[model samples]
Target: MRKMALVNQKGGCGKTTTAVNLASCLAGKGRKVLLIDLDPQGHAGLGLGVKPDQIEESIYEVLSGKIQIIEAIKTLEKNLDAVFSNVVLSAFEQVMAGVPEREFTLAQGLKEIEDNYDYLIIDCPPSVGLLTFNALIACDEVIIPVDSSSFSLNGLGKLLETIQIIQDKAGHELTFRILATNMDRRTNFSNRVVETLRARFPRNCFETEINTCTRLREAASAGKPIAEYDQHCAAFLDYQQLMKEILREEAKMKAKGFALKSFVEAKEKVKEPMEKEVAFIIEAPEDAGVQIAGDFNNWVPESLDLTHSHGRPVWQKAIRLSPGLYQYKYLVDGRWVSDPSNKKRADNLLGSTNSVINV
Candidate 1:
């Protein structure tokens, strides 16, 4: 079976939405698919119309060894079966703490029914905890659903770093694909974010983009996938294209002997130079919208936005620069201001001072 997990430490990035819809679409294609909800919120099961009260035996029971995997399985559709989750699953980390090889609990449990499905889709929790680790250990591939927001872009680097750590510590080889979700095609900022993502991770990004659609949210609220809610909607078409892209990639990989392995290795080889590039950072309120504007690109702030640093109020932008002096300013919530962190200043034509830096 082809196993994959949808993971992102940041919330509201369409991680659960993608997981539920993708699994439903895959199963609709006549493939036997199993979606395992590793999230404590139980949103995946709930998205499929499985109420919390209806779930007596959840993934918590199976992982705790209180019941077999089959006992927790609930048939959702013709070819789709799901292993539900509940709030009690939140206690898994504390409960399994101090146990040897606890990271492999889910992996060990999957061995019982690994042969019964064509695809195994795991919806991981929003945090990088023991439950997320178990999903990582069990899956060979990861799909990171990123939204067209600056905050979402900010978390991408840290999430990649976490994945690298998991690979090194577990001694496992895994590949990842970036899926752009919640995309608003009408806005230039959204388009720019997608362009930035593609430029940063060209080899790992999927060509299919999930556009912003109200029907998608309505479907989730109605406890149905886009396919069942409205097959003719744009969201359904986007997901169908995404499904086709995945299947096509799988076929191409099988024909070329899984060339993506080398693609991932190539990314690792260029990691050092990428990290050494110049970065522009500024301190701003977490609630304020921040962007960098300078002579680099005709002083258009919309062309370059700053991303929030992980767990901090500071925002940053990393860009390649040659050895030269540059002047810039920060555009915070529509007001242009000099960078407080940079002491060096230069007079601009606008009768104001701009922060100066030498690379």
Candidate 2:
């Protein structure tokens, strides 16, 4: 089972919404899903129509050693069960603050019931406190929901640092992906934020952006996943695409692991040209003529001009190049800048980081 946590230190990033709807959608695909509410706020349960006052035992009990996980879980949907939490959990951090092995509390509790579900989706609290630490230790993977607002983008680096801390101190390695939520494509500011996030973490960012939709809020307020509330709603469609992307990525990773030899053989036998098409993107004024400069074109600034993609604010260009590592940057309206989506970069002699791409 893949235990995935939707975590973000910043608030109002759609962590609960993604957890509720994503869990429901996965369950709709016939996979047994357990949505664990690790937050003290308990919105996960409340959003699912699970009354806060009605739930007797929650994840708080499980975390506190007062009860086992199964005792606290309640089946909400056909293929989905929830381990809810509430405000009482706010005291848990202080209670467990003095306990030994505190960071592994959540991990230890879930380990006993590991086989009960095909996937576990955890809704983490907004703060990077003890609860969030436990989630990090317990989860096999993390999906950081970053809002499209410019300010929220600043938290991405900090969360990545937290994951690095887990890797260093806890000795647990985890893969992570970024989901851009609350994206308003109609506004250039939001679109630019999304593009910048994609450019900074190209390998980790999901291609499917959860565009802003009022139906998402309506579903939450009505105590239902978008799928159950209004299947035809725009929110439902966006989440459906997100679910499909998640499944596809997981399948590809699984195939790579279980069928490594065949996969490699098949890839080698494809006999496709070694040259790859690399997409260079950067956010610039609509009328600004962005050009790419790198070793690929002998550092010529005006060799390749970028154009907007389907009325989007960001400029993009796809160039075919042979298999190799290349250092490149964009000249946006005459000013040079590194690709914001690519974190892998090298410091040039000019004291600027050049984005690195390998094909």
Candidate 3:
């Protein structure tokens, strides 16, 4: 099973929007999807047409050991099931404080139901508190909802630091990427924010930027995923493409035999290679430009421009160079950024690491 969490420490960034839509889209594609509402606000359930009072048991009950996780899961349309959230869960931190192994509570509870679905979409709260921590520990991967706004990038450092803490205590098994939501191309500010994000979190970003649309809100108010509500809508189409990109990335990570520890190691490993042709299948944020530059290129930061697949954002390019290892990063919209796809990374003078990939 591929468990993914939609998280953002900043509110109104569309974390729940992505989770609800993506989970519904996967279900529409005939895949079993479980939407876990880790947020105490219970917006996910409301977005899914499920009333909080209607749910007899919730994630709170499961975490508290009052009920089994499987029992808390409420099946919705086709292959979609959701474990609704309730306001009572807001007290989770205080209640779970004295308990040992608090981080693994959600993980242990999810073991029984993980394999039952192809996708488990978790809608995390705005704050990265205990609830978000549990979701991080329980999930296999995370999709960060970065609203195309100026302040979005400012919170990244803190979010990453929290992830580091969780990695130290729980386990370093989770991978994450930025999923730009509420993107408006008509506005110069929006475009600049996207550019900044591309430059900042290169490898950890998705290749699809979800375009803002009124249909998204309409769909949510109607309590349905975009795919089910209106597949022709731009928002729905963007999310569908994003889902495909995520599946492709997951496959690549699995093929590389990456797990939690080794993956992080791979992200930090950067070295000169002895191969003449270095083929890099880089996973970059959608619409971000990638180029090669290093000692061989005198760190010009733009020696080779990477090309994308025709009509697709998944960037791929092959370069011919001397037989030695090189350090490089993707240039997304003129902003230099590290590659999050590869596990091997090497720190540069700028205090950021260039994700290393073996030739």
The top-ranked prediction according to TM-score is 2
Ranking by lDDT: 1, 2, 3
Residue 240, candidate 2: alpha-carbon lDDT: 92
Compared with the true structure, what per-residue lDDT tens digits does model 3 show for residues 131-232? 988888887677888888544433765676677667667656566788888889999877876765564455566889999899989988997777778878
Q: State each model's CA lDDT, in order.
A: 0.80, 0.80, 0.75
Return the number of clashes found in candidate 1: 0
After superposing candidate 1, which stretches have Cα over 4 Å from the reference? 256-359
What stretches of model 2 exceed 4 Å from their correct place?
254-359
- Superposed on all Cα atoms, the candidates' RMSDs to the truth, in angstroms, are 10.2, 11.0, 12.0
The residue-level lDDT of candidate 3 at 312 comes to: 51
**How does candidate 1 score on lDDT?**
0.80
Which candidate do you rate higher for lDDT, 1 or 3?
1
